[model samples]
Target: TQLLEQSPQFLSIQEGENLTVYCNSSSVFSSLQWYRQEPGEGPVLLVTVVTGGEVKKLKRLTFQFGDARKDSSLHITAAQPGDTGLYLCAGARDKLVFGAGTILRVKS
Candidate 1:
């Protein structure tokens, strides 16, 4: 069976604060994807890394794929109130398995 588990299902941080979210799994994956979702809106793709040990960045957000493709992480250097939303990580094999999600609230 394949499964993706994300830690810290919820997080609340003050504006301009930093935070990190972790996604882990026992199964190997060819690629991994990250997405952010807002209320009443569909998830938007943040990044996708296919190679092991690959890393990508978007503005203040940093994403890393595990050396074995079994895990991933997202680090936000300075979160803002506009960043408040649900963050999701997915492991891609033959199918995409999504983690429950991490609800982040960046308070003013």
Candidate 2:
């Protein structure tokens, strides 16, 4: 079974807005990764959170890991059209378990 779950299967937002996406799981992961995929391509790794209570920032994007390492969140500041894509969260244990993903569309 998939160990990870992502919320907001679909999201539509305008430029300059802020939004947050969540990823949850019942099982603890050794590490968690966030990825963004565009049309006709594979997912590109955005960030990885290993330690509990870890927070990572990539430009306007902020990622946080729960204290238990079983959940995570991604926050985007000033949404942009370039940020439109499928956002995926993956948890690594014996293998990489990916959530269904959140499809985000940012319109200008």
Candidate 3:
């Protein structure tokens, strides 16, 4: 099985909606990095929660790492079209193991 699995795969929302994406795994990682990507562009680091149970917030988004370092989550509040992008959760050790990803679309 894949090390990481993200749910929904895709999400669509209006200008002012809330959404959450999940990342689950059976294996533990040293660290987890959440990235957001635009078309034809490299993934940009949104946050890296190293310590388990760590919670970091960026604008309308919140990220959390599981206590066992085996999973993570991303929550977005009051979404806007500007929030539209592909959200990817990747677990890393010597290398990164990525989830399929959750593509979010926020329409005005």
Candidate 4:
């Protein structure tokens, strides 16, 4: 089984601030995906990185995959209160293994 280690389990920041979250693993993966989830709702996929060193951007957010395919990072610029939620990274081999996730609270 693949295991993912996510850093800064919880983060609280003021609006318009920037923050970065990370997901790491010792095992390699075929693909990595990032998601955002709000209370009482299922996760919403933000981006999928299938190749090593891949980087994707969505509005104020940027997602990057490590060259080794064992790690990933999410950077959010000018964060807003609406961006507050759970951020998750899932790595896939034959199946998907998810990180414990980071909880972000962007206070206005």
Candidate closer to the true structure by TM-score (higher is better), 1 or 3? 1
- Each model's lDDT comes to 0.92, 0.96, 0.93, 0.95
- Quick one: ranking by lDDT, best first? 2, 4, 3, 1
lDDT of prediction 4? 0.95
In angstroms, the error of model 4 at 21 is 0.3
**Candidate 1, 73-100: lDDT as tens digits:** 9999989899899999988888888999
Worst 10 residues of 4 by lDDT: 1-10
Work out how many backbone clashes candidate 1 has: 0
Task: State model 3's lDDT.
Answer: 0.93
**Model 4 lDDT per residue over 1-108, tens place:** 329999889999999999999999999999999999999999999899999999999999999999999999999999999999999999999999999999999999
Candidate 1 versus truth, CA RMSD in Å, comes to: 1.3
Listed in order, each prediction's TM-score against the native is 0.96, 0.97, 0.96, 0.97
Off by over 4 Å in 4: none
Candidate order by decreasing TM-score: 2, 4, 1, 3
Q: Which 10 residues in a row give candidate 2 its minimum summed lDDT?
A: 1-10
- In model 2, what lDDT does residue 25 have? 93
Per-candidate RMSD, Å: 1.3, 0.8, 0.9, 1.3
